[model samples]
Structure formats: structure tokens, C-alpha cells
Target: MKRLLRAVPIAAAASLAMPAHAQFAKPEDAYKYRASVMFLQSQHMGRINGQLKSDKPDLALVAENAAILDVVNKLSFTAFPEGSDMLANSRAKPEVWSQAAKFKQYADRLNVDVGRLLAASKGGDLAATREAFQATAKVCKACHDDFRRD
Candidate 1:
């Protein structure tokens, strides 16, 4: 009888601790994750833009180049899995969920562009890298135009 009572309260407490079907453990965690992704995006975009404007463009020379790639790789590998914090980001347009196919297309195109830029980065092939960077920028802009709000 005592064990049953203890178990009952434990179960009740556990149930109360978490909401049913809750995607994020905490709202702040969602915010943190979103901020992290935003930081990575800004860094990546800024480096490419600066590289484009430089007389001798080279992504490899950027301080955040390797770090950006590290985050980018992480972003690529971490599956949002529909209900992850990234999916809950307010900056993430509803179209990300509603039009997943098109979103994925943009994502794939961005991947190819990023890959090309990285591959061409080491040999001072700034022009070629800039072309890829420009394509990636277009992909970002296109998606934001269609999916994100100001």
C-alpha cells in the first residue's frame, strides 16, 4: 500500500512536469536554438558578402570560415524532424512547414552552392567562389521572399 502510494505521486509529478506532445522542453530553449541558427546564418552570409566585395576574395581567409562551416555542417546534420526547436522558430516561415518540398529544394540548392564555394576556396579562386556564393544568396533571398516575413 505504501509503495503504491509513492509510485502514484511520482507518476503524477512526472506527468505534471511535462506537457503532453510538447515539442520543446522549454520555450527559452527554443529561443536559444533559433538564435544560434540565426547567428550561424548571419556569419555565413556576412563572410560571403564581404568576400564578394574584397579585391582578393577568399572565404578561407575569413575568420569565421571554418567556424561557419562547422556550424553549417551541424545545421545540415541536425534533423529538425518537424517538431524540433528550429521548426518552432518564429523566423522560420510557415511555408517551411506548409511547403516542405519547395523549402527542401531551396535547401538543396544552397547546399550545392556552399559546397562549391568551399571546394574552390583554397586556391584563390575568388571569382568562381563568388559565383557560387551569389547563387546561394539567391537561394536564401528566394526562400525568404516566398516563405519568411520581414
Candidate 2:
């Protein structure tokens, strides 16, 4: 009885901690979650861009946004479950599911580029940060070109 009770709570906690992709009850929910995460990523990217364009860039602000982007980047890819791309507002292309390996490659590259951006920002190297930021943007553009619809 005691062991069963302990196992029950452990299972419940594990269920509660399920990945976002599995927690979605419907395609729409996944689409909404993906859209929200993308919006966050865009917003932070814009903030970092604005700072970069400034006469004197704020490395601290860029680092902060980069950190947020790292987390948001991870969330964005997980929300794109198989059926979510069928939604009316979804920009994801069929290739996202059909070419899953290629899509995953882009996702993995984005994570790596974003990590570099974060590291550069935190290191307070403006030149390196700019280069890393451009690389990150390139990955994003490449992924969108291949996987997103018009």
C-alpha cells in the first residue's frame, strides 16, 4: 500500500512535467503555443536589433534578450507537432513534417547559433556579438525559407 501510494505521486509528477508537445489536447492549442513562442522570439530579436543599431550598444541588454531567446528558441520547435501545421494561421509548410530530418537540422543549428550569440553577448565583445547575431539570423532565415509558407 505504501509503495503504491509513493509510485502514484511519482507518476502524477511525471505526468505534470510532460513535454509541451505531448500536453496539447488539440492541434489548435499547439498552433497557439507555437505562435506565442514565435512572437516572443521575434520581440526579443527586435529588441536586440534595436540595441545593436544604437550608437552605443548595451551589451547587458543584448545578453538579457539573448538568454530569453535561448529559452524561447527551445520552446518554439517543440510546439510544432504533426497536425498543428494544418491550422489556418500556421505558416509551417508540409515539408516540416515530410522532411523531418532537415527540419530538425535547422532547429538544432538555431539552438547552437543562439548559444553562440548568448556567449558573445555575455563576453561583452561587440564585434563578436554582432557576428554571432548575424549567424543566428541567417539560420532563422534559412529555416523559414525552407519550412515556412508564404
Candidate 3:
């Protein structure tokens, strides 16, 4: 009876985990997930920006936020599936599908700039972090200008 109880719990856990792996089963799911990730990234970036503007910027907080941004930047590309552009709630432009290669290039550039920002934050140099942040923000702006709808 104990073994049966343990097995039941294990089976239930496995079933719960299965849905997590199949999270983006539809195009709208992917679009919604991408929107959530973008929202998270923006929130983290805003935190870092707020810190940078403060008189006593906290390097530790900056490093943590930058690390999150680094990971989020890598994850942002995976959400843009082929048909995701057609989703009603998606702010992504149709050019994302038509100009896939260009969009990917911009994504790569943003990833690189985010990496630099993370490195700068880790180095604990406020000036370097500011410069890196500006570079990263510019990459984001350029991509948004070209691919995202206002």
C-alpha cells in the first residue's frame, strides 16, 4: 500500500511536468509567452536604468539584473515561431516573418551587447556599466524600430 501511494504521487508529478514542456502548443501561446518575457526583460532593464541614474548605484543589484537580462536576451528569440506574427495580441511586425534573417541578425547583436553589459556590471565599474548599458539599449531600440509595432 505504501509503494502504491508513492507511485501514485510520482505519476501525478510526472503528469504535471509534462504540460510545462508542452507550454507553447499553439501560435497564440508562443506570442503570449514572448510578450511575458519581453515584459520581464523591460522590468529588469528599467530597474538597472533606475539604479544607474541614482547617486549611489548598487553594483551588486546591477550585476544581478544584468545577468537576468543576459538570460532573457537569449530566450527572447525562441518565442518567435513562424506563425506567431499572425497572432492578434502580438506586437511583432510581419517583417519579423518576412525578414527573418535580418531580425535574427539584430537579435544576435542585442545578445552580444547584453553580454557586454553583464560583463561590465560584473566588473563593478559604474562608468563601464553605463557605457555598456547605453550600447545595449541602442541595440534594443534599433531592433524595436525595425521589427516591433508601437
Local distance difference test values of all predictions, in order: 0.56, 0.79, 0.76
Clashes of each: 0, 0, 0
On the 0 to 100 scale, the lDDT of residue 84 in model 2 is: 67
TM-score of model number 3: 0.82
Tens digits of per-residue lDDT, candidate 1, 32-93, equal: 65457656776767876886797876556642473465346335322222433243345556
Best by lDDT: 2
- Model 1 Cα RMSD, Å? 10.6
lDDT of 2 by residue, 20-69 (tens): 32446667877888789889988999999999999999999999999999
lDDT tens per residue, model 3, 10-126: 332243222233235567767777788888889998999999999999988999999998887766776665656766778899898678768778877877888888888888988
What's the TM-score of every candidate structure?
0.65, 0.85, 0.82
Comparing 2 and 3 by TM-score, which wins?
2
Error of 3 at 105 (Å): 1.3
What clash pairs does model 2 have?
none
